[model samples]
Target: MIAGRVRGVLRPLSVVSIAIVLVLLIYGLLGYSVTAVVDGVLAGSVTSPSAAEQTLRWTVPLLLMGLGIAVAFKAGYFNVGAQGQMYVGAMASLVVGLWGDGRAPVLVIPLAFVAAVLAGAVWSLAAGLLRLLLGADEVVTSLMLNFVAVLLLQWSTSGPLKSRAGTGQAATSESIDAGYRISTSTGVSVPIFVICAAAVAVTAILVNWTRTGLEISLVGRNPVMARWQGINSTGVGLVVFGFSGGCAGLAGAVEAFGPAGSLRAGFSPQVGFMAVVVALVGGLGALGVLLAALFFGALRAASLYLPVVTNLPQSGIDLLSGVIALLITATGIPLLRRRRRRRRAPTAGGTSEVADRPVARRREVVAR
Candidate 1:
């Protein structure tokens, strides 16, 4: 039993170690000093209070989006349109904030947040509806929607919402009112902290403590089996998709009100994709995503700082993320899937372990 627990702990650690080793080898082969790369990472991530703040700033959005993606994955749905969802959410927030310019910040801010969440949910559910109703592939529909969202952002910023005060070529919307801003440019503030804390609490409770959570795990592991046991697989799918999109939308709101203070075309282009990687690396769990987001946030900070300290390009950090993603795909995800299958399968004693509950509890659920 002790050995089994140790192996379980080491499984994730081994994947991380291998990814790091591979990154070091790649950098070494490219003629960059591995030590300098390591130093640059530390300096960018945790060298000082300012550095830590920067890391936290990136971590906030990543955590939100990662949690959203993790939830969808838990229900066996692949909602890859976080980028589009975030864009629509940002656009919704921008429109609301701009429309309510003369209103009180307290009222306007909450309205903008609601608008953002609703917009994101609708955008995401569009794809889910297509998948469920029309038998469309969600991965394709969701990914294609990303391009549509980018085009929408481009047109809106360049046409309807364009800021006239900007002389630069980059298209951008007018800045949000100062009162509505939750954080400064650094993206770290009390309001931001409160929001993240609330999200973590709510998500943990939803995923770990609710009957819905058990349904999600069961559906993910084996949808047919879940259906056989009278679970509403379609409802579970929609719930997860909506929840995931809402989370992504909230992240966009956080970005706009906390750090960005405005909507810019093509803003934070990689954050959505990076968040997918974060979810996979995190083992699709709340606690794991929190830790993984911090890890990637440090990498994000380091990527920016590496240009200042070494000859390496910023894409080097992306390469590291890509490598880690590959490793997780090959090892972590498959391992988890297999283990889940094992738990659901019957043992030699003719008793099933099930996913979140024992076989007896599963029988009770089926009977109901």
Candidate 2:
């Protein structure tokens, strides 16, 4: 029984254990102490109070953004422009926060989020419409939009939103009034934690308990078949894209109000991209997304403390995350998908229907 319980625990953690070992091996080969690497990850990620707070703070955005990406992927949207949508949302939130100074704190905060959601939905529609009307590649358009969004933020920070008091090398917006800030420089707070819990609960209900979730899954697994079943594929696409983008935007709003308190150039530099990895790592499930976000958040928090604890550079954690990402995508994802295909064969009406889908018929709707 003891050995059985150990096996059970090891089975679930197999991928994580292998990834960690590979990272340690690489560091050892580079002449860095594998012991230091392990020590640094533990101390910098969890042992210290400051590190814990940082991890929690970053978890907010990653969880929010990962949910959005999961929504898109579940619908086969492949909307990869979360970075761009986030920037747009941040821009809108900053505007509301800075310009609506006399408004009640509660009113302003919610309004900022509203503005962010609208901005992100609108930003994402640019690609969605193209995909719908012109059959354009969403991956390309969404990725390209990221560049546009970044430039828009750069212009906003350097021009209209530029704080005249700024005397630093970086471009940033004027600070939001203290009354409108959600959390202080400490970054983590009770209200924020409650909000995160509410978000997770709501997301879980929406994905598992609602009709829309089922429809999205149906559409994702087989869009052509979904259309035959009277589901409006176009409408589904629109809602999925908007929702995915809105979630990313909400994360941006929170970042502005809770942590940064002002728009800055290249803020949370790789978070949008990292969120994609989180979704994939989580196996595209709601609970998986949360756990993945928590893990990545810890890694991000430790990236700061790593340089101080050992000879490894701050980039060491970044490299480790990259390695983990590679291992997951390379080895596990295909296996996961193959298993899913087996389980889902009986789902597309019957094995005959899936097997009988002709080559030309399947080409009617191109997926990115």
Candidate 3:
């Protein structure tokens, strides 16, 4: 049993490790200093206190989104709209923060957080509803919503929420009160850390110890079988959608109250997209996601540190993220084959073993 569990864990970690090496080698081939790249990546993450703090800050959003991605993907929903959900969530929090100006932090902060989470969930529910109710493809709906979210973000910053007396460099919203700030602009704080920890704990419990999680896994593995077993596949999809969006929205709230005190036109640009990579790299497991989030978060901090420490362009780290995604997807072939094999298994009675099992059991038909 122990060996089985260990092997299961190793398979995913190996993929992530291989992907990193491939990315590094590719960058080196392109004329970048592999050593400098490694050093620059580590400089802020482990070698410097301030940079380490930045890594922690980045980890918060990535971890939150990674957890959500794990759950959604496990339920077979390709929620590519996490970016949009995060944006809408941030927008909701910003609106609440602005309107609650002068309100007690104790009250306004909680309210804004709820608004952010709900806004994100509502946004994601659109794709879920489209896919489940109208028989539309979730991939298309979620992907398209990303562009809409970006436009909405632009409109929010430049239109009603624009800060008066803002400089020419970038448009932004008015700052919230200091007391309402959960963390400083540098994005590190005890409360923020506590919030992140709580998120992980909650997700772990949900995925590892609950019937909903088991049902999600069952539905993901085989929807027809799950339905035959009396599992509500549609209900599972909707729940995963809401929960996933809520997690993304929570990440947005963290950004607003923790690192960013106001809504900037564009901030942490790649977090949502990178989070998908983090989930894949982490093997879509809670513990794996925590580790993956820290790795990616450190890389993000390293990206910021690289330009300052070396002559490498700021885009270098972004390349690493992109390459990791490309390679991880390449590793999906074996799993695909396994799934296909499972689909083709046959019982001695010559029935389709995979599909007929649950459907047969449902009708009290025993397999010989």
Candidate 4:
């Protein structure tokens, strides 16, 4: 019995393990030196002091956004509006920071953060509301919102928030006050790390410990069953959407305060989408999300360093990431089909046994 159970557990894991290895082998055969690429990624991510800092800088936003994506996935919502939500959050924070007029850092910074979070929540809630009320498809709405948010950022930085003495191809708002800035250009700071840690901790607790978390999970797994069980699935959907948006917004605020330090058009353009990849690779669990974020963060940090150290272009890294995402998604199909077949096979055998046994029992009773 123990051996049977062990085999059952190992079967799924072995399949996944083999799939990952196959992906690596394919990449290796594509004229990419796996060893060299791995070494370069590690060197760029954490071998040196500056490299480690860059890794942390990249990890923070990815982690935050991954957590957000996990929340939406848990609640059965596909909120692809994270990119747009992040842009709105950054824009909101920039407006607050610029207009605060030298207010106390304690006062202004917190306010800006709150504004960022609220902006993200409102932006996401629009999609959720549409999904609930108008029965609109969220994927389309969220994807379109991303472009709208990008344009909004361009407008804000180029028009009202344009730097007074700027001369460059890229438009940017004025630099934030030094005192208000969270970190230097290097992007690692004590305060920002603390905020990210707190966000992750609180989110994890909410998902694991709270009643709402249980309800949301139920809703995701089966909305009809959740409603039958007396859970308010609609409320759960709204909460998840708001929470996801808030997390993305917080990431945007961190970028504005720590690394970017000003509103810039197209800043962190596809990072939000990349966070979805991180969440999926991490297995959509909090701990998985954290680890996956670190891995992707390392990739982002390494991408910058690769050009300096190797002959490869940044496009190579992009292509590699895209390949990983595609493979992971494609592998899900066979795994799911196998699981479904396994489940049905047992049910079919049990039904046949029940049919044959009842007839045999009746014959034995009549013969006796």
Candidate 5:
């Protein structure tokens, strides 16, 4: 157990180290000094108060979304529709905010939050139900839904919620009412921090100490065994997807009400995908996700700040993130396959327990 904990800590650290080295080497070959690059990264990410604030700003959404994705992952569903779910959530919040203009913030804000969560949960459940009822692949369906969501955002910003102001370059909704906004320009606030902290605490408890959490783990580890144990895998999948999408949606609402203050077309473009990396790198634990979100958030801050402070292109920082994602995925596959194989292997007596079971009971379990 001690060794496992140590390995867990080392895995994320190694990914970070390797990514940093690769970025440095690549940029060095491009003629930038290593010291300059390092200095710029630190200055842009955490050295200054403004940079630290920016890092936290990005961390909020990433952490919330990561937590949700981690749950889906643990339940054996690869629900990658967070981008679309987030868009839908933002659109829902925007509609509510627009309709509630001039109303008391206490009233409008809660309504907006509920609207966002429900919209997101429904969007995710659409994919989950398809998988459960029609045998559709959740990964493919969820990913396709992301494009649909982007289009929806585009139409809403261009047609329904389109701002009447003069700026024509970017399609965007009118700014949310000032009273309903969550934060100022900095995008970090006491309320926002409290919300994120509460999410982390709740998710941690739900995943680590609950009966549903055990079912989710069992389902992910071995669905057939889970079924034999009388767990409802389908119901678990629905719960996982709903929770995941709701988290993503809440993040979108936070973004819309906090720093964004309006829905912009293609807002937070690749954050959804990056959040998958955050979930995996953080080992899918609440505390781990928190730390990983901050790390990625710092990288995000540095990426934008690099172009301003040094000759390094923003892509350099992006490349580092990509490398880390690649490493995590590549390393995870073998371990997963190995576990599956070990679970199926025969006992020391050279007898296969599953094989020896009655054929009727050994049949491939189908979803209810």
Candidate 6:
């Protein structure tokens, strides 16, 4: 019994473990020195004080968005629009921060953060409601919205909010005053860390210790059964999606206020997508998501350092990420399909055997 339980627990863990080993193996075969790569990753991510800060900087947004993905996955929803949601949130924060015009930091900061969260939630709800009401696919809607959000950010930064006296290839909004900023350019700050800790704690409790969490899990496993149990599965679905988007928005606000300090075009472009990978690697558990965020954070930090040290292009890191996402997605598909086939095949075979046995028995009776 103990062995069986242990196997059950370890089964999910094997997926992430395999992915890590595979990534390492591929890196090794590419003529990249394993020690140097490992050491580089370590040296870049945490061996030095600056490296640790960089890791933390990357960790903040990844962790926030990963948590959002985890929640949606737990509810059996694929919210691929975190990137769009984050963009919208950042844009909203920018408008509020710039327009607030030097209000007390205590007041302006909280209000801007709240606006960001609400904007993100509302943006996500559009897709969620469409899925619930019109049967429009969430995946398609969310993915398309990402482009729309990106375009909107470009418009905002270049047209209206463009920083005066700023001249660069990329347009960006005026920087928030120092008092309104959450952290300096280095990204780590007491406020950012405190907010992240709170988010993690709250989400962990919601997933592990709340009735809503139980209902969300039940709906994910079987909506029909959940409905039979008198649960409002549709409502649960919307709430989960909204909450997930809101978290992504909160991460965007943090990026604007804490590290980036303004709305920049293409800011955090792929962090939302990376959060999806982090969610998958973390096995959709809050604690797992935390650890996975750290690992991916290390990778992000290392990616920046690689171009400086090695001859590898920054695009190489993107290629590696794309490969991992493809492999992981492919791996899950087979397992899911096999399980479905196993379930359906047994019923199909049983029915066919029952029909055949009756015919054979009749033939035996007629012959006798």
Candidate with maximal TM-score: 5
Per-residue lDDT over 55-141 for candidate 6, one digit per residue giving the tens place of the 0 to 100 score: 889998999988988888777777889998999999888888988876888888999899989988888888878776665667789
Q: Is candidate 1 or candidate 6 better by TM-score?
A: 1
What lDDT does candidate 2 reach at residue 281? Answer: 75
lDDT, model 6, position 274: 90
What's the distance in Å from true for residue 227, model 3? 0.5
Clashing pairs in 4: none
Candidate 4 C-alpha lDDT tens digits along 11-46: 434444565466457657877677776677778898
Clashes per candidate (backbone, < 3 Å): 0, 0, 0, 0, 0, 0
TM-scores vs. true structure, each candidate: 0.88, 0.87, 0.88, 0.84, 0.91, 0.86
lDDT of 2: 0.81
Q: Model 3: per-residue lDDT, tens digit, 1-368? A: 68966875787677767867887888788898888878888886879769888888889899998898888887777787898899899989988888899999989999999999999999899998887666566779988998899888888788798888688467787888788999888888899888888888988888889999899888677766776799876788899999889999999988888788888866777888888878877777788899989988998888888898877887877777777777766774355334334332333343445666567787775543
What's model 3's overall lDDT?
Answer: 0.82
**lDDT pick, better of 5 and 6:** 5
- Cα displacement (angstroms), candidate 5, residue 104, comes to 0.9
**Per-model lDDT:** 0.84, 0.81, 0.82, 0.78, 0.86, 0.79
Q: Across residues 172-287, which tens digit of lDDT does each residue of candidate 2 receive?
A: 88999988888987579887787778767867887789988888878777766676788876787788888888988988888888888998888987999888878777766678
Tens-place lDDT digits, model 5, residues 72-181: 87776778899999999999998999999999999999899889988999999998887766656777999999999999999899988999993888899988899999
Q: How far is candidate 2 from the true structure (C-alpha RMSD, Å)?
A: 6.2
Winner on TM-score (1 vs 4): 1
Cα-based lDDT at residue 366, candidate 3: 50
